[model samples]
Target: MYFRLEDKESYKSQEIGNLIRAYNRSKREEAESEPLNLYVEDEKGNLLAGLIAETFGNWLEIEYLFVKEELRGQGIGSKLLQQAETEAKNRNCRFAFVNTYQFQAPDFYKRHGYKEVFALQDYPYIGQRYYYQKNL
Candidate 1:
């Protein structure tokens, strides 16, 4: 579902705001929560983008991942994904999971040997939501 530009901006900001508030609350609740670990390589020793994973039960979730837009289509996403999967295995997680909205990383995960474990229509917004997993 697409909305007018103004509405889109409003929705985006609202979502981000909620995340910030929740993060702050969690920080106060648990002073020593495990922070996500990220891995990346610098392009010019100054700038870089990477991936992070979070643990929950027997699964490691690919919490966030990015390879600068300019660096897309250059195998960066693949390398980052490979590294994340390796990290998952090292942690003894039986599976790795990630969710993405429509037009997001579902295709990327599929190419990297993950299988679609769940798909929901109109999720988060009016787009499909995909959850993928790879058994380790």
Candidate 2:
């Protein structure tokens, strides 16, 4: 077997995508998963904050959460998270998990009752990656 690493600016490769999709399908069969996407928009219909997650088995895995810069610290993030949690609960999820870097919103997630389950030091740079989970 031979393996090679090559860099591509476009990062759009159907071969890699199909490989991932096949693996994901196997995992989905192992445990049922449902996609959940939620977002907040202003009166003008501009996106402010949002959360993307998936509920699998009895757990919810949050893949992304983003808030516009101008809307930070105004409770928008919290509201978005709360809404996601509500939906997850409705789906019978008993726990929720997410990952955030040290320079990101680790503390914010902590404040929301998520405890650090794992930490990878100096990942992607001179920063840490934290995995957190909370009981629903």
Candidate 3:
């Protein structure tokens, strides 16, 4: 056997993810995943903010939440997060989890009632990574 690093976007990397997912599905019948995405756009269809997430079993995993820099502090991110949480609840999800960096929106998640469950310091450099969870 040989070992080599593949680019993040390489086909082998994606295939590896698929293999893991397949194995998980084989172990759990309820391992199917559903995307739960939300977006805020202007009248002209310009995107102002967006959220990307997924629901599996009884949990919602938030992948990303982004807001236009100019639109920050305007409550757009809060709205998107609220909407996503509502949708996750509707999908029968009981919990949601997300991770953010120290430079990202840790306080924002906390303000939305997410509790920081873990923190990894000196992660990816001289910063911290925080994992948060909320009960829906």
lDDT of 3: 0.93
State each candidate's clash count.
Answer: 0, 0, 0
Task: Give model 2's clash tally.
Answer: 0
lDDT of all predictions:
0.74, 0.90, 0.93
The best-first sequence of candidates by lDDT reads 3, 2, 1
Task: Enumerate residue pairs that collide in model 2.
Answer: none
Q: After superposition, how far is residue 6 of candidate 2 from its true place, in Å?
A: 3.7
Better of 2 and 3 by lDDT: 3
Question: In model 3, where is the ten-residue run with the lowest total lDDT?
Answer: 5-14
Cα lDDT, model 1, residue 135: 83
What are the per-model C-alpha RMSD values against the true structure? 7.5, 2.7, 1.7
Candidate 1 all-Cα RMSD: 7.5
Model 2 bad stretches (over 4 Å): 1-4, 9-30
* Superposition error at 75 for model 2 (Å): 1.1
